[model samples]
Target: MRNRLVAGALCGTLAVAGFTGCGIPERSEVRVDGRRQPATESGAVNAWRKEPPPRSMSGTDPEEFVRNFLSAAAGEPDRAYYRVKQFIAQEDDHRLQEKQGSEVELTVVRLVDKPVITPDIDSTRVTIAVQQVGVLRTDGKLAPPVSTDTRYEFGLRSASPAGSVDDGAGFYVIDPPNVLLLSDVALRDYYESQTIYFWNSERTRLVPDLRYLPLTVPNERRLNEVVKWLVGGPSDWLRPGVVGLPDRTELINNATGGNGRWEVNLDMSGDDRTRADQLLTQIAWSLPEFDGQLELKVRNNSVLTEDLGERRSARALYQGLDAPVRYCVYEGSIHPLGIAGESPGAVPLDPGANRNVVSAGFTRADKQVFAALVTASAGRQRLSVGTGPAPVTTFTKGPEHTAIGRPVWLRATDPHQPQGLVVADGRLYRFDQNARMSQIVLNLPPGSVTAVAASLDGRRIALIAGGALYVAALNLDGGTVAVGPPRRVATSLTSLSAVDWGDEERLIVAGAAGRPAIYEISVDGALQTPLKDDTGARVTHLTAFPTNPATKLPSGAFMYEANNVSYRSSPVERIQREQVLDVTPPPTGVRPGSPSAPFFLF
Candidate 1:
């Protein structure tokens, strides 16, 4: 009977304790005084009547569970609160961990499990299963490792006999063996995986600075170096690259040291070669620093070879040698035909298309005359006729007359009354009808007059004396009188070589001082500004070219001699020089009923 009694007590205890699914019985039967109760129908009824219904566990909401889980995973209060506050509400008695002096406060970051409850007739036991998330102060040494799979256990008691809950409380952390606390290795690995990996995911790739790299390093240099190589170097050593362009060629005439001189000879076998050579020569000579001169000579190879032994094609010859004197000969195909002799004392019966004529002795004119003549060094007499086998009029004493030096210019006034000539010595001579001698119209200033240019209407003339500018008027009776006081245009003017009438009111004068510059002056004694500031060399001569009337563009070539080099300038350059002259034609006719009637008339 005792054995039976013990077994009955054990079964009663099992019924009250409730069955655990892990190999435990569903119920236990025990007496009211810890004695075993018989497993009879009556006993079971009494025991069942005494038992109470199961009380619900506190904090069992699924949303709360999930919120707690995520908050703990995130590990920041503000971030967790913002993320999870919408889902769960804490019970009134919920308490956060607080600290004293330097200790950090800890709050419940998350709860991870459902609560379970067991109940009997007189008492109840509650089990709160949760994963607690918390923070500890690290003094910024390193961040605390995240806790994983941590568990919490808690208990709750009923506040009133009515079974309303008084308090739900818990204390928690991960248990020893089952807990995943932050280990040194684990924390480092976790940091590298979770924090660092996530941070670096959004960053851009890195590039390197290569300028300071060692010589053996292979990398792109600075952008500037790359650009310099692509373009030409600063010295412009490389030609720009272009498809189908001609290879760059250089023709250098290097004269090294004081008197070391060399000349480059170019031979052209075809028209293409000649064209190329000419273009290159122009480009080289145009540079301001080249300081070299070029000469082009063309000879017919066919003629030379036919006359000699072999057929000689067109060839270029350059002769260069070190010497005190330098000369460049430019010879073209056309040879100037010369009129052999001056017919002195002979007059045409009808003036016979004699557009140009010369007289050695006294001459006469119907109107005023402006002329430039080269003087004899010893005698005051001016020679207008040459005496030799190849006789030509001798004017300038400077250089001998050559094919290149033959002077051709224009003269105009009234065809009915033509202006005559004025010598450098300021003697006015008129063309006589007999053409044998010049009739002295007037003897004026005996000072050397280097240049004389007449206005379009022949009413005014500009004369240069001792580097001074003088303006004079021609009376209707062919008399000359000074118009204004002698004006000093330039004090250092050493020579006045040429003068051209820019318009009816101003003159363009070229001469040497320190350097050559072209000046414009008004016939009324006004000085306009110089044309170019400095040409860097002396100007020997200047002349205007004929232009097209319709376009007002020069139709022929204007010429200037500078640094012993003659240049055929474009019309644009000539006009730029004209601006220095400051001469403007009046809207009305200045020369009426004259051959150059409307002075600018086409």
Candidate 2:
């Protein structure tokens, strides 16, 4: 899809992350095209010499040259590559092109101070350290916002002594050119994020992976690039457990579309014709953003799909897989939300549940809801299971421990019921049917974890610890699994109240530091587009998806408290409902925080 439609297109562009210096990749020949110089009459060898391009920096001042190198390098990948090379010696012309893939557009967020340049022999050791934002790493993960410093080796040459010539007369060059450093705000404006959706063997989930691309492409070229990247397959980190595009296939011509229909022609002679259906399926799942129907052709010959007769949206493969099975509560009750919100989407539960449960969760398998319950207002908290009814089963009763927030349920496809995760007394614990004892998942400093939510795929978890949002890789094996170091979701969001998977890779976040607005932020921190229609009020609670979890429509509903009254509203349609489905408002006096009040779907 085009950058305009990207839900999490953070800022005018998306975000980037950490930066530490690494030597530029080895040099390769720079391709000089015919367009570089204008053509003159064939036989006439004119007496003309090409003028040197304006210098980014002109002088013996090595420090300013370092700054100029960065300014020149922060541009369209190729243009910047060539511009930065002018600062290096002629011998290192290919370093930028060879080291950074030709297609990569660099977004360098500079958070560094003045450089310290020390002259040594013919070489000047220029140490340029910076706190980088929006930095992309080789492993396909965004770096966290932190100051990581490195030095650049820039060799210099001089034509005269200090008093012999003008200050701008001598020479200062960023020696190898490969170790160029840069910093600027506008770098992000030229980049936008694109997503490629892939699925597991069961097709139970569509994993959205993000890729940052330049906005230089036009609509047609953008569409063509999307097709090319989709067929190119997902990033290495997300490659495991997800399907890959068929081998030996490539796009022979361009992809063209009109009136919401797209024509994709591919070269198919290499091999594996048996996987035609899989290839088409991949394309089908990807075209919804364009509001498109695809007509795929192999070598300009149409591949008919009418015979199979089973057409599915990429989303269709993952329906009901991550549906919130039960409504979450902050007070002492559990209500069944089921797969569809229709099972009951309001507050103030009916006569079936216990009154002591403060937080709750349930499985996709059944109505059975599990919760953290306090026997009394002053009693110890314990884990209990019930079917939204009284006389709940006491599963795990621990010491007088303080529960952080609500308990989250992760429903595995296993024969057993859904798994439960809760944080108490600064320790994260998990619960199951046969095991009544608490198994710690991860431990943190007291009050560090502000909020927690997991992706639908169940392999990753999102946390708001230490007042910042982060997505941590999760390994949920019988609890010995580890939680990898976190990648902060947004370097800008310092105060986030809640987070839920908007799609596989994007998250709908509320309470972005100081704003009343909500943002469609990517899990990798690359994109953060504001939800189009304003929430009409300070957004206090958010449900990631629509009432129908299977539906592809982004959720327009949110809960906010105003004028001392809580109301559920859809700012998109400008609809405000005083009552939230069947659930009644808090009984007379008890008021759960908006974060605690919004009904959580499984």
Candidate 3:
């Protein structure tokens, strides 16, 4: 773990899995200083910063200096990268000093093996071999690597007059690579993940975009970085799904704030007032974690005359979208999970109907509705949708002895009308607003889509097909639905069983290269972090909730299953996964006697 061993090296290939985002919670509780802790340090979490590595010691050997330089480079980008520059040769320091930061920069997150240090008569070379994990850009967006095997050679010369430290006493890196090399442990210590917001294609709601900023850096610097990234736009993979600030919309001045209030000035004087409201909306949602009054001005002119002091909350802007409770379908009834002070009783969607629902997905918007895959008989299944006291409408039936995954409810483009997606056998189908079911053609990799999950915003979809994972943009044009070209992501995952959206940017996936495991992967196919859990059984189901901007906590309960055994993460535990037995026992809650897919009511 210290080395950030590339996922492929540790688990085989890059079967990306894990969850990340500002309002979203990661799948596992990270351990630090021998105690379990929250995965992120944003918002009200305890403030602890990773100490910066010390400056190079005098008379240190080439190997020691190289090691120290790497450690320092992993921390906050110091003024001119001074601390790291100390280990460079005198001639190399001038080059680094004159270099200006660009829109993006590559940072090495994992090393495939120990660096090879070879010393010669006149120079030393430190060859680092790494498997591409992700490219951390200067704009705070992470891009997937174009290559898998990356090698960097650091050439060193003696700082002494002899030109070389033959006895390994004195040396400095004479030739340094352009990219920063960081061990995985250093990445975790020095960086904290944060999410900024962008407008959805419809500009109806803000979508979450994830970025990691240095924990040791000052809050103002971090805030400025977040704002700049928001202005620069979303990451490459997310660009197609979200809208950003208008073109050439650059921050005129750095974001400055302390205690709570912050002010952002932009160079959008040429833009009209119509864009001003949308601009403020994006800034407010993106900075929800900053928790303060925001003053926005374009070329020193106020965007709005009304005070926005109370409108800084993302929840205030996007209301009624968060799920109030999680639900689980067992036998023939739906029951709420982990709702306090309420009886653990079944809520009937169809009164007097014994449909024998085995798995279900529901949506709660203007009205409560649910879609269920009912067991018609042994080896046969039927998909149905209904509301309270309404006769359940059976829309489609699956072929005998074939597999049908849990239906995923898509965020409706039309109000009060819900839509859903299901994958039966190898085919994918969408349930339209009128309860009409139709198959959506896909040109995915040569594998059957066994599991599918869609983002809450209805902008993207993730699929597990043929033991691999794929992602595509979900395009809703009027009443017609279209899936953009599918891109094969997380090839590092040799096999995949279940997939679900952890947030707008990350996916919670279950599968393995050598053993059954769960991983959180960014939607872009880069940045895979394993979810620490004890379950050895192959994960069969995953139920995750994006962080509710209102609570700054996960929207609802998080649960997953392995070999039909269910586990759930309580609100008290945040996103840490635990066996459901600790919360409730059989015949009452999630202890479904047979295979079931648990989900939150969203």
User: What does candidate 1's lDDT look like per residue over 574-593, in tens digits?
Assistant: 11211211123435955311
RMSD of 2: 12.0
Ranking by TM-score: 3, 2, 1
Give the winner by TM-score: 3
lDDT on C-alpha atoms for all candidate structures: 0.27, 0.48, 0.60
CA displacement after TM-score superposition, residue 483 of candidate 3 (Å): 3.8
Clashes of each: 23, 16, 13
What TM-score against the true fold does each predicted structure earn?
A: 0.26, 0.58, 0.75
Residue 596 of model 3, lDDT score? 48
Winner on TM-score between 1 and 2 is: 2
Query: Compared with the true structure, what per-residue lDDT tens digits does model 2 show for residues 327-425?
Result: 434334544332222344333233444566655444344444444333335665665543333234444544456554545665433424445555555
Please give, for residues 482-549, the per-residue lDDT of candidate 3 as tens digits.
77776666434556888887665667777874678767666655456566333477877887775444
TM-score, model 3 to reference: 0.75
Candidate number that wins on lDDT, 1 or 2:
2
**Candidate 1, 257: how far from true, in Å?**
74
